[model samples]
Target chain A: MPRRVALEGSHAVSEAVRMADVDVIAAYPITPQTHIVERLAEMVANGELDAEFICVESEHSAMSAVVGAAACGARVFTCTAGQGLELMHEVLFVPSAMRLPVVAVIANRALSAPLNVWGDHSDVMAIRDCGWIQMFAENAQQAFDLTLCAYKVAERPDVLLPAMVHIDGFHVSHVVEPVLLPEEETVREFLPPSEYPFPLDPDRPVSMGCYGPPYIYTEVKKAQEVAIENSYEKVLETFKEFKDVFGREYRPVETYRVEDADMLLLMMGSYAETAMLAIDALRERGDNVGLVRLRLWRPFPAEELRNVLRGVKAVCVFERAISFGMGGPLCAEVRAALYHLPEGERPKVVSFVGGLGGRDVSVEEFEAMLRRAKERVSSDELEGFEFVGLRE
Target chain B: MRGELSWKELEVGAIVTEPGNAAEYRTGDWRSERPVRKQELCIMCGNCYIYCPEGCIVLKEGRYETDLYYCKGCGICANECPKGAIEMVEEGK
Candidate 1:
């Protein structure tokens, strides 16, 4: 039987890392993410987990250390949030480009200008095109499961790429919830030891991070794009195996109450749970409302999303991060995914940017947002985007 | 220098499977000038051998020569020679 215990989201991530039997962990402390590395440090000190816990000075050094370790055939793990991620911005591309299977857990938080340190999608969205397999977790349980699955997905021979699991900082990272911790033997069976095909060794040395001039840069990028896009199949396969072993099913685009509904609300991260409650209230009032939660961000699951939105009449996307002059990043991507649908089948996508800088997005706000989306669909003159729950 | 593999044959992430594949690249093609050694004026201080950026300077037996196939003709060896035994001459001269 699996052990069920109430664990904080960050602790759940640490426990998952421990069970994954990571050989190295290089991380710098950042808000919401600090607890994760802290717990790992304790585990190492207490001899509970045998791993090299490197205390780096900055996030850049932390990422660089993990990249070096992974290249040398070590199963490495790391965690970061907000500005720490921003500090490691340039280093983020190297691991994926080198095809090193380094797993990182991102406690998603808002970026600075106002210098906020709270939960949001701004951090992850900033590096959406960094060539890593990115996934979002709505709760503590998914955070633990996805962290383990990330290793299995990244270490696959056909999909030798770095992976990141994003948990909304403060909202998901700080929340204490009951999580079923899998046995060590089961995790070991599911995710066997990673064997890198080409690792840096003195006896058999290989040049990594070689300079690519203009002549081959385009081809290199094309190859990377194809690899990431193709890994979608491997991700699904890994999730299926995980479900069989652990009994927890995960999907790229998870839906709720959409069978008979015409209006759909789309969101990612922890806010999706709140949106479900709002959907229930609207359903009780005889309204046709449903919810669509996005789990995979990078290598965007366009096919799965298109299939889910096939018959939906209207879609209201709740975005936690704004793209300034443009609108919500999530809303823009959702619209682009649905752009190919025929005119008669396409749904009117209403964009709503909210919960930025750690601001709370209430259930009442979701209800009002849905009402606004329905009005726009009926009026046939939809507004571009709006900042929901803005004080002004 | 042309690439051996077509774009289709190229591996993802531009990984170089063979060790020391740089040896086949012939970086000497980048040279605008070449370093010529004067054996008569040579002191054999080995400064040129140490300073050569590409490590192309070779001391075989008692003779010191630059491996033109791999040298980029940076002229660093010529500049570092205390006895002026190495000279940078225009390539193909």
Candidate 2:
């Protein structure tokens, strides 16, 4: 039986990890991310969860330890935010190259020298090419749901890439919300125990992650690219299986009231739900605008994104992080996905950045963004990103 | 150098099933310098045999000789030799 419980997004992730029966939890504590691994630590110390909670000195060692554990065919997990994610950057590439499904949750935050510990997409965007499956959660419920999906999707034999569930720091990570925590038996039925097809064993020894010289590096990378791209289908299959068992359906690109809307606001992370708040109020006033949220960030979900935005006249890509000189990290990618649409048929993609460093972008701001975005589309100003709620 | 494998032939994560690599690959071509044992100044100390990571140094014809087939010319043997019994000469010479 599923029980409704109030939990912070961090504890939701830990609960899912606990039920997943992860073999190792190796992570150093960092703000926002701390609540997750701390709860996990308590679980292990109290023997509520039987897993090795390695006390590592730094995020680098934390990532390194999980890689080794995963390589040895253990279901491994770790969590980090902001600077901690950057600290683990180099080691982040290892699990994917070695095809180890080390599950992780990122309480996404801003990078320093301003030293903000608050939530944003900057932390996650920095690791875009790290070759890991990325998923964003809108709230505590999705944080719990996506973490479970991540483990199942990542541990699939053909798709053994590490996965990161991005839950907005402070917004989702610290805020307590009602979550439908599923029974252990249901999760067990959903995700089977993961086994690396070629487990490192003494009897039948195998050397993994060997050196790839220049001659083979390109080919090896090509093979890796093909493998990850192919995993998109497997991800969908996992989502279907999860839905069959849990009765909650998830898609790479999730849509809401898009059928008749001429304009749509596509966003990611927790703010998408806030955008929905604005969408509801606007819909009541006869505004033909909808919402499109990207649940899956990597393997890009290019096709699904296209399907959702097919006939919409314009799309306001609301992102929490900017890509500096160009525009929003997600805005650029959304444009590229829609680039192949026949010239006049493509939606005018107006980019906007807001809610940086845990700053709030209010319902009125989203409503204002829509008016400005529609104006920009009409004025043929579908170029560069406009910062919303900027102080004059 | 030409690769020994096609991309289609790569195992998952390129895991090497046959673990002992010293014998599987002839890493001789990797050497830019070769160690030539000075048979006359030999101490029979066996330091080269102990230090060679490839384990290609052994007593052959009553001399501690470096096997050319497997030596990577890492100069470990020359560096470890106390009596200057092994001289590392340029490969072309």
Candidate 3:
């Protein structure tokens, strides 16, 4: 029995985490990410979730607490955003390296120097090499569904990696959308209790996260890389099974009207929903356009992305974060993925970064970017990334 | 050293699966100098015993002595001795 209910993206994520029967949640609140942990805290207080809700001091302790909890073989979770994420940066590597299945959500926010709290990908892009399995959710439903899938994939014995579900701050986290909640028994069958092989216990007397001096350090790191790379199989399998049980489909790269399009708009996070509207508006106006949304961000589906973009003419990557000296981070990775394709088959990846600090890139604006991408890939020489709406 | 272990053979999570595995590392080979104790000046006050970074000093015969088997020859024992009973001699001699 599934019930359709309207839920904000933050509550949607927290609801799925509750259904997963987590053992611990160590979270410190930050803007946008606050709603999610607040909901979880409420659930724990109401006895709706039978889990330890630890109110930690800072985002660093929030992450470190989950690492310790996961090391003790507990199903753990945490949430953070923006500057809070950077605070937790150093401890972020512990879960993945220690092979702990700590599932957390990032309500994606812009990093600060001038200090702005808004929806963006800057927080996520900074931690691209942290070795966590990251997935970007386009809307509330996807956020809920992916959070559930994260637990299954991360706890897989062969995978044994931490997971991050990225939902755009304010845009998705605050917006209310309809999500289908499956029965508790259904979730129980889908995600079994985590069987973490190396639980820290006094009786076992095993040392974890031990110092890896010289020779073994390289060996250990190589093993970790291989493990995360190889997790694609389990992640895909779990997604398939989730469709069978929950009846909602999930994929590494979700496409909208991509067939025989003259150009494609590639993006991630909640913006894809708005981009879809623009694509439709353009499609109706006789411009052949499509949208490619990155659902899986880590152990990056490079080959899958290349396969999708191979026959396409060109792809305009719309991103919310900048790679500073370079262009959009996702655009850089997309180019690298398409680089191996035999010259003519590769699509010209046009990078466009905007909607930063939560500024809205309206439907009309997206249509313009597609036209710009087509013009550049069609007649004009290729240019680097463009920040679409910056004032002179 | 388990450095010979292949990537596949390394323990999951790189956890040291064995208890008391630190004792197996013969760090004494890293020594550039060794601590020597003079019997006459030694009061067995346990200054070196507490100050030795490796905790390798032991009271063998009512006098604190440095055990060379596990000591890294850090010279902390000689540096900390109030009576100047210990000297750091070069390893070759």
Candidate 4:
């Protein structure tokens, strides 16, 4: 039976992991993410969940342990944040390269020198090109929902790549919210039993993680690329199955109030929640403004993004992390996605960087940026990069 | 979990699973050469002893002897040794 409970986002994620019947969990405790591992430990201690929870020493060891477990044909999970994620950067490449179906929950936190535990995209962005399927959640509900969705998308035999579900640290991780927990039987029916194609069987032993010669290296990488590229269909199929089972549909890119709007704002993560508020406020004043929240980050949903923003006159990309001197990383990617479109159809996208280190972007400030962006669009003087909510 | 294994007279060769023991090798068990220190080149820097993946490299009378029984031969010791004190020749090569 489905359990109806007021659960925190972290607890909700833990609930889904428990329901998924993950065979092994290798984890370490980091701020914001510690709640998830704490809850999983409690479930194991109380016998509420039947699984092996390994208390690894460090984040690096945590990923390494999960990689071993997954390669050994066990459904595995782990969570980490901030500098802890930086420590595991090396092993992150191993799981995807070896094509082990491991899933990770990343509590999005600011990377630190002076040491801040707030939310940002720096940690996940640092590992963006590691060949893992990455997804961002807008709120606690999506945090819980996408946590389940990650397993299905990652474990597909055609797409045996590691996946990470990123949720803003304190905003979604520490916040309590109403989440609809699905029944165990329904989740089981939707997600098939994991069939480990390569398992450690004494009777049928095969080598894994072998040193390949140059002759086979390119072939190995080509297979992984094809697997991830082909995974788009499976992601859509599994999401449809999730919608059927849980009645909650999710898309790679979701548009809000964009039907008749000429101006659109492109953003991601928990900021999407605030952007929706901004959208609603603007619509009340008879302004044509909309928002597009990118859920999938890895596959670079180009066609879907273009289709949604093609008709819009102007687009503003609010990025949380800066790519050093180059400006907003997400804004650069969004502009590139629409670069090939016809001149008239291509929306004038203004890149804005804000919300780093858990800075709250007020709804009023968001509205002002929209007005400024529209002015830039009208005057044909839109700066390629603008830092929002800056003092100067 | 119960299986068939003869315990009465366990041969050394019985447990040392060689390549082609099965159709394919479990690369998980593949290890590097067990470093046998040439006493003449010994500089008791203890690099090999500290960096050995299996921690089987030990100092005996100012010389290092790597335990072949447990060593996977990752060659961490040979690679980490600052001096040319340890050489990792392939086992059974």
The reply for model 3, stretches above 4 Å from the true place, is: B28-52, B55-93
Candidate 4 residues A223-324, lDDT tens each? 666667777777788789889888889998998999889899998898888888899999999999999999889877889899998968999888788788
Model 1 C-alpha lDDT per residue in residues B1-93, reported as the tens digit of each score? 435455566654677767656657768878999988889999888898888878888978888899999899898888889988888899878
Best by TM-score: 3
lDDT of 4 at B86: 72
Clashing pairs in 1: none
Local distance difference test scores for all models? 0.90, 0.90, 0.90, 0.81
Clashes of each: 0, 0, 0, 5
Q: Which of candidates 1 and 3 reaches a greater DockQ?
A: 3
Could you tell me every candidate's TM-score relative to the true structure?
Answer: 0.88, 0.89, 0.90, 0.80
Question: Model 3 — interface RMS deviation?
Answer: 0.8
User: Tens digits of per-residue lDDT for model 3 on A242-360?
Assistant: 99998889899889999889798999988898899999999998988999999999989998898889978888999999988887889989998998899789888788999999999
Query: What DockQ does each candidate score versus the true complex, computed on alpha carbons?
Result: 0.34, 0.54, 0.65, 0.03
For each model, chain A TM-score? 0.99, 0.99, 0.98, 0.97
**Comparing 1 and 4 by TM-score, which wins?**
1
DockQ of 2: 0.54
i-RMS for every candidate (Å) is 1.9, 1.2, 0.8, 15.6
